[model samples]
Target: MSLCATVPDWQSPDLEVFSFFLKFCWILRMPMPTLQTGLPPGPKGSLIGGNLAQVGARRVDFFLEVARTYGPIASFRIGRWRLFLVSDPELIQQVLVTDARSYIKHFGARTFKPVLGNGLVTSEGDFWLAQRRLLQPAFLKAKVVSYAPIMAELTEAMLAKWPEGQSVDVAFEFSALTSAIALKTLFGLDDHGDRVQIDQSLRLTFELLTRRLDALFQLPLWLPTPANIRLNRAIANVNAVIDSFIAQKKAEPPGNDLLSTMIAAQHEDGGRMSARQLRDEAMTLYLAGHETTALTLTWSWYLLSQNPDAEAKLCEEWKRVLGGRAARAEDLGSLPYTSAVINEAMRLYPPVYVIGREAAADLELGGYRVKKGYTVLMSQWVNHRDPKYFPEPERFLPERWLGGLAGRLPKFAYYPFGGGQRLCIGVHFALMEAAIVLATVGQKFRFTVDPGAIIDIMPQITLPPKYGMPTTLMRR
Candidate 1:
């Protein structure tokens, strides 16, 4: 009954040829359900890499083509792994909302763990739920509203520093501004020296992270490569700053800042997050809180410069609403066009362009049988530009969002902030901060892109202007 007895003897010459054939079959075999039935159709790919070569470089374009060519539910392969790109809004909702429990954060999220640690963005199951519950109160509408003053004030200071007609890199300027705002609002680090150190470390960390994420073949972190060395140093620098902040907070009474609020938070079982947890959470907030907002503002400026009509409308709204004064939290509602411009800009170039997950079990999505362990990709870049939902999809039209058009769209049709229980906790904060900054800056100046600069989209951790957004500021 032994299995070896059922096979040819290893010493036999015939066994050698049989072994080679078996190896060949294994190598060439597609990692999907039997090709005879079930699994959805996809582009044929090479044996070794599958569709990696075809879909790796220009992922957004590739996904859009897949959706356009194969309809909403398109299947592909990356090496031996089966991948699915779901473009249909209803199917996307199932993956992100209705059947969300059936999937977990995919491999893409793991790449963030080296920087974010086991914080809110990376943790799963009970730990993630616990962290979310504990941090919920800090981002409540009332608490977020209190940070509006800080956002508006920081933006006003930033505007004052710019020379009247100077051509500056708006992307870099916004990054610095948002980093300062995040530090103040999240950790209450208003000291000049502390803010400088933290901001520099954050910039380095993000640069390294973006490179690693976008690389076709990322080297292991343990290697002593120059990028890895730099990443280690950047992580250490950020950790040093965070540890200092936590130690300083521990020695003092609780303050109104987000860090202090988190430190003082306790679970029903009376458990508090340890020092390590606190550091992870702080780093997560710092990275997630600032970068997206900055990229949004950066792209907003570029879009406005390209579309002068939209820019004019935004300026008119600011002048009519704020009357050349700094924008306050209350002014957010009055400046509808400014908000619309930001909305449209995000629709055109969402900072977090894609949301990825992995199937935990066999399932059916959009009438296709998706086997277990497949990677599920839902891209905002593709879905946001769907012709069915957004007519004249390529045009930058802000007015389309003016009259509850956004609310009327299918639920997942326009999720710049994502969806489901894991929706970005800083959604309200980001929207408020963007509106305030746009209104405050728009009232004073208009930015025009440099004619000679070629701005390219570097879609890494965020969609940033590859060459930086070089623009001259004109006093309005």
Candidate 2:
């Protein structure tokens, strides 16, 4: 049986007792050696909850404040959990690249297992290595470039429905567009009925997952809480959609889509992925593949609307490169400004803003002795906005990326897609998709932020516009 099949039952009597004991220990402020010695300085927390309340209330701000207040490395406690936040680029490289083998996906990533299963994001060690190797070919540059037409076509179709000079939620629109593109590219599912059903299921699953992240204490999966029930149903719905696609693929001959490729993938031992494994990988790709790209586009539109000069530059570039036609794969190289706009937008609002990992062994990091079982956090949100690396870091300056300026920055200082071996597999796919979609849509329309609408960031599975970005689309 797979580890994912064993969802921890938190309501068990022994587990409840353990939880209570931990809470009791936290309340007494027990001076464990790990907590007392050689740890970086951070804000002292309450006896019981530590800094969790503050973090839960405003995750991004809390992280930024800690980094700002405590220098590059900071330490805090939540119950018995010791978390170390690393803000220095070199330390980040150590955790993600140089000494990466000493870490594993953090407990926070386990929150995704109910939905993502033991997929790439949550899996570890040999299994994760095998799965990554098996699925890598699907995301190769050649294969990803082939999907550009599908991305452009889908964006163009979505843009066709927009009424000129009318307010629309660009966030929602981009979500739908990207979801459609993800479906087509991954499964060749062009049927409108299937797309709608799958999109709703995936969205509901993510929504529930987001709520789970916000909850301070999690109930066991078997508990009959309303949220738990909804989450289970959403997971079921998503699994049904994925299983259906897998069944169809199994029945038919292989095609070039990711599903077909995955169906035909084999391990070095000449073994194929189990059905459950395939389901997990497919769901992982489906969720990660679209949500981040969609959020990037959403934030891009929001940022471009705020920065008219950037928008104008992007428009001019599209006109020069695309000539009033939909962007193709080949044109991505020529549309540096378009790429830069996406890059800057992601830097400002990274989709996966907070990345977490757990130390596999007691280790030294950032000149501090971080003990085993400690959670190590790295925030692109904080790093990307550091004025040390980026002058006027808060500003949306796409032009900064021109003339090899990005290459000059310190490694891990500007990782919108993260870094190292665990770096996003679909980086090329996402960049191509974003460029094509931006060019295709920008050639025909421009959006202005709707007045009196507050767009805030909701850092969940992805950083999404909290209130949904309301904007008016103007035909060009």
Candidate 3:
């Protein structure tokens, strides 16, 4: 079928009273309805869009100061939109878990529909409920346990390729490593060559997608400008790759592949995801699964590199547990310290730094009142480091976790996988994967950050290490 056929006649909507109800896929013409009141003050920037002008400069510092001053919820008007910045874990719990249905993702997610289609991350109401159910089984503990061997197998392969005493970008390496693992285990393969083309395309697509998603308030993606054109092309390349995979999967018998599980998933009403929905969901997993894990590993490696005592403890634990052998899924039960190390690193530099939601109705949170249509922002960056929960928050101390701090802390105080229902579906899988990969990599090698390397912060879809962590790997 032609691409034109999938696009609906949007003009028909303007004629109907139900124009607002139209799926955003083909209704890009209407002026977006503006949001008004949210909460109280922060750094008001340009008169046109408060704080939007400074979005490019030291956003980490800007957001930190906002959290410090606002104490949880703040309101700001950017462009034609009003936003409510939320930093309180209790309110975040209310919005994302308990009262989740009251809110919908911001319209910013509409741009992802072109790139991702309508998978779990983009679907709303029943569609989202149905999609999440169908894909849930494949990530169950037993099923995930089956993938641990794959993770260990690949970690060895990746480490072998690393050169001794040579400085390398551990961030990029972990990304590539996890990307390969996602392909193999998700698709029931031991090797992931077939997915390499799409895998590489993801970094490109995501970079563009992040920029476009961040600047959604400025203009639409259809503009004939250099950046927009490049982004569209990136989106198209990714769409084509995913579309091809879906098409190929259709011709084959139902297999153990994650895609097959999603394809065969049937809702209570007997509905299954459309190909586009599956495409989007698959892309979501591809993006969320790979990038976040990769970044976590990168930062974990960075922390281990910086703290020799901690790194020595990690190596000791690995050697004692595995003894020059490979790590397995069950072995993680005895490796709580390793898990704690990963936890501590993620606390300092989380993969999804800032999470957001849009208010479905007026709500009160953390001494502020938010109106409907206001943007609600939450940061793992601010919350995890809020000294109230984590003393000496800047210090990377893994022992705090193993020392019963996790129990002593309040609910949602350190939600690395996020909290409530929208919490990362793959939390278990990610933990297992990280434990196995960390143990495997730690057993074979150690990393040290190259001196004089400037560590900057880049707040894209995820807070990637801005300058990137280039470190030297010494073979153990």
Residue 420 shift from truth in candidate 1, angstroms: 0.5
Which tens-of-lDDT digit does each residue in 257-341 have in candidate 1?
Answer: 8888888888788888887899999988987788899889999988888899888888888778788888888888888898898
Which regions of candidate 3 deviate over 4 angstroms?
1-38, 189-200, 213-217, 268-272
TM-score of each: 0.89, 0.90, 0.87
Decoy 1 TM-score against native: 0.89
Q: What does the lDDT come to for candidate 3?
A: 0.77
lDDT of 3 by residue, 331-373 (tens): 9989988989989989998888777777788776666676688
Q: Whose lDDT is higher: candidate 2's or candidate 3's? A: 2
Q: Find the 10 residues in a row with the least total lDDT in model 2.
A: 30-39
Measured on C-alpha atoms, candidate 1 has an lDDT of 0.84
lDDT of each: 0.84, 0.86, 0.77
The residue-by-residue lDDT of candidate 2 on 1-476, one tens digit each, is: 99987877878898898778778878899743343577899989988778878887888999999999999999998766799999999999999998889999887788878888989888988989888887788889988988887887788778778899899988888888887888788887763566567777766777788667656577898899998898898888879988987887778777778888888887788888888999999888988888899899999998888888888888888878778999999988898998889889999999999888899899999778878899999999999989998899889998888879788989889998889999999999898988888889888988989889998987777788888999998998
Candidates, ranked, TM-score:
2, 1, 3
